[model samples]
Target: MTDASLPARFERPSALAFLGYAAAIVIILWSFTGAGFSIDKVVSSPPRFADFLDRAFPPNLEPQVLARLGWKMLETLQIALAGAVIGITLSVPVALLAARGLIAPTWINQIVRTALGFIRAVPDIAWALVFVVAVGLGPFAGMLAIAIDTIGFCGRFFADDMEAADKGSSESLTATGARKLDVVACATIPAAMPAFISTSLFATEKAVRSSTILGLVGAGGIGIELKVGFDLFDYPTAMTVILMIAVVVISIEYLSGWARTKIIGVVR
Candidate 1:
């Protein structure tokens, strides 16, 4: 082959790229130090973990224990379902308002987007504590926490989907003397509905996972039962509770994955 026809030698990344990588490493190390990371503590972790395992052996397989765990798991799943429904219902309109391409008013879109941000800022666990204070414990608090988080989680994505919708359809409808609401209903919403449904399904799965931990704040679910086991130093029971939760979570995850595939033709 002629020298001119030879492929150019593959070049290494520039020094600037290496410098950027070095800077990122430095920042990560600095943050790790500030957070008090320690190799010595990590090295000593396995024995403590082993002791935990020793205590957690011989899982609690009693009928009453199994029944209680089953009931709590059911409660958690119900809370997640209810929260997802409530959140998706509430998010749809807000998501529409936040879609800048659909809503021409810049101020309104910005405000809606900002509100979604604020809603998503607080974690579900924190929201659970807040609701626990407001509602005085039980599944209701967890439901509300999950609902609020779902609104944030699904709304932002739904808004983006709405915004990403083809403008030509919306414009064509509007040109035919269609009102703004009609235009969105006929053009944007239908286009985005599948994506919205898929997002809601994912959000429901996320809520199911969050529901497990809400019991930490006495909001309700299997977490409270697990807490009691740990508090009593009943590691066998705790392990049983953990396994029960794992089974339920995995089962629901599989079910949701299958549903998503059927409905949206996507696994995730």
Candidate 2:
């Protein structure tokens, strides 16, 4: 195609884009004012932070403390694992149901999508608190919260992947004697499997991070221990716990990312 024959560009910035930017700026300014935000206070807070950090020096990385950290770390992992598994199990069907490629029924797809959206709308900590109320304070609450969060994350991920999958394969299967479920199982699911696994790993990493804070709501994990150290004015111990959390989070992120990358490589 000649330059003149080439289609017009779709997204040259226009008044709508300018208006959106203006609205965003206004909203950002309003948000700061509404929340009584003060950049000056933030700048002034560094000394207080420095003092706190100074007090947190020589973290109590004693053998006993490290051992406790190891145990709590294991508990956090277990909670994340349980939640990821449960969330994957629950999310898969909803994802399949919401996948427009497989499910042509608009109402059904909308319903499933809306339900997943509702779950996704709630923050992990809020859900943790709710679960703590329902299940009592323990890793159980953390597990439930993580599960809900995973469902929220992975469900949408899976559904979007499924929707975007090559409909040709699934359509071809449907053209044969395949049932709707068979079409999805044989074609759509397989096409999206790698993406689903990768997304699930991402969600699992998020769950692990969130699990630390869930303990604040009595969801059972290292967070409770951290809170305890903080409440006792044990800055060294709290710092230790914080370091432990950072270590685990980084470790999980690296490990999961490596695994996902390897899997993608293998699949390709």
Candidate 3:
């Protein structure tokens, strides 16, 4: 094809494009002002941060404190694990309903998609607060919040993964006199299992991180300890809690990554 026959590589942006860009810039500036962004505060923050570090040094090493924190951490892990399992289990069926042209009708798919979106729109912390009020502030409430959050996280990805699975195998199953559910069971779900596992691992990691802070709202975990330490100016204990949370969260992330690689590799 001659250069003259080719389409132009660059064209002037439309007036609407310029208007959109200007609007984006204005919104950013407005957000900065609304969020109370201050150059002076940023410049003056170092000394205050240093003071925090000074007071937080020499983390509490008391055997009793360690034992107490250990139990709380264990509770947090339990909450995360139980919640993730429940959510992931529920997500499979919900995802099937949300997967367009899978086992569910178009209207069912739309409804399920909308419900998943609504679930994801609300923050997990807000869910925790709601559950705390409902369940009277305990590990159970935290677990419920994590479960709901995981459902939102896993359901969306699971549905997309199933929808993107190899259509050839599913079609073959359907053409062999298989029912819609049979086709999904024999072909679609198997094809999407690896992605489902990966998403579940990610959901578990997220639940762990969220559960750590759920205690701040009295939903049960090390967060309550951290809050109490800060409230009483027990910097050493607070530092210990912070360190523990960091270690656990990072460890879970690394483990999740390793599992994803190994499991997906094996599946492939």
Evaluated with TM-score, which candidate comes out highest? 3
For residues 1-268, write the lDDT of model 1, one tens digit per residue.
6667766688677999989999999999999999999999999999999999998998899999999889999999999999989999999888888888675588888998898899899999999999999999899999999999999988899999998877888889999999999999899988887788788888988998999989988989889989999999999999998998888888888888888888878765
Worst 10-residue stretch by lDDT in candidate 3?
259-268
Candidate ordering by lDDT (highest first): 3, 1, 2
Worst 10 residues of 1 by lDDT: 1-10
Candidate 1 local accuracy as lDDT? 0.90
For candidate 3, list the clashing residue pairs, or say none.
none
Q: What lDDT, from 0 to 1, does candidate 3 have?
A: 0.94
Q: Score residue 57 of candidate 1 by CA lDDT.
A: 90
Using lDDT as the measure, the top candidate is 3
* TM-scores for all predictions: 0.92, 0.90, 0.94
> Per-residue lDDT for 1-268 in model 2, tens only?
5566756778677999989999999999999899989999999999999998999998998998899878998899899999989998899987877877575588888888898899889999999999989989899999999998898888888999998877889888888889988888899989988888888888888988998888887998889889999999899999998998999999998898789878875421
The residue-level lDDT of candidate 2 at 142 comes to 93
Show where candidate 1 strays beyond 4 Å.
Answer: 5-18
| Candidate 2 collision pairs | none
Q: Which 10 consecutive residues of model 2 have the lowest summed lDDT?
A: 259-268
Over 4 Å off, model 3 = 1-12, 266-268
